[model samples]
Target: MAAPIFSLAFALLLRLTYATAQVDPALISRACEYAKGGPTCVAWLQDNEDDAELSGIDRSDPDSIAFFSLKKIEKEAVTVSEAVSAKLSAGTTEDLSPATQQGLAECKDHYVPAVDLIKEGVDSLAGKAYPDAMKFLRTSTLDLIACQKSLAKLRTDKKDTEADVHATDAINRRDLLASHVALAQSILEFAASGGGAAAASVAAPPS
Candidate 1:
């Protein structure tokens, strides 16, 4: 009886191990192939494997991975918005020109709304409302574009190299946000087209 029980326990353990295994690298590669960021998308997802929200997901499913990516985009938007706010606050003591200050303020305005749109997108995705999710995600990019334009105006009217530097830094952050959004959109497209539909049935949103 002891031998039989021990064998059954070991079998159960094996099943559990397989059930919770890491996401398949090939699946990630295939899904990321359609992303605008391609290799960068793959690396980003892999690098964020330990993220609190991502760590609990069904990594084997492309849909779950795609959902995770959207959550990441929302977080990034919030982070960028906060950083821009901080920069604007520091302008008083940072030797920033009026034009540079205005540009940073505009970027903050755009990013602040973008964070809300991204949150809505994540909620839509969690509910399996694909069209709504896509709509929100796409709309969020409008703010990013607006922010980029603000930075561009700063660069065009830059008073000094310092203003240029500030514009460049903001642009880099905005570009990263855009890339993540594109990657998330691509992953959603893949999932909706038969790559995986597990997200449609997921019981809870990422924490």
Candidate 2:
């Protein structure tokens, strides 16, 4: 009976260890540490371990991980853009201030370019052109920052609680994109040099 109990405990421990070994929590956390989502971003990556975009990916390869991260951010940008566009298109705008409405409109205008830049980065990654990928990511980062600034200006002009809520959500979305781009840049650097030079290059991603 004692031998059987010990065996059972060992089996459970092995299973736990196997599960923990499957995903690198530290990698996810470090990758998303700069984003607004923070821990939530890490959780998102963990939850999406089985995503088709990441299928059969070698998690140990920095390039592969960066590609996967870029694809994820691209999807997120698409989703957010679509949602905001639909809201502005079909939803009533009479309740919003002119500043808020204008800001949202500007965001909609930039969404296409933003997604395009990310897609370009994805293509660059696929082609093994890490520097090109980083450039595209940087361009998208700037676009997101511009969108956030637009919303920030809008927020200052209006004190409506509802607009404030919308602004907060929009800012968070921008931050997530920015974080993912930065992570992708870092991953590329790590892949290129393995250590020292990678750290210096990624310490300041283009703008």
lDDT of each: 0.69, 0.61
Q: Could you give candidate 1's per-residue lDDT for residues 29-116 as a string of tens digits?
A: 8788755567887888776546554454455676667766786788788777766666566566556768878887888888877888
Error of 2 at 168 (Å): 3.1
Model 2 stretches astray by more than 4 angstroms: 1-45, 49-58, 86-94, 155-165, 194-207
Report backbone clashes per prediction. Answer: 0, 0
lDDT of 1: 0.69
lDDT of 1 at 123: 64
- For this target, which candidate reaches the highest TM-score against the unseen true structure? 1
* TM-score of predicted structure 1: 0.74
Off by over 4 Å in 1: 1-22, 155-167, 196-207
lDDT digits (tens) for residues 24-133 of candidate 2:
56655555553334766666665554555444333444554565577678888886676555435432443565666777788877878989988777666666566777
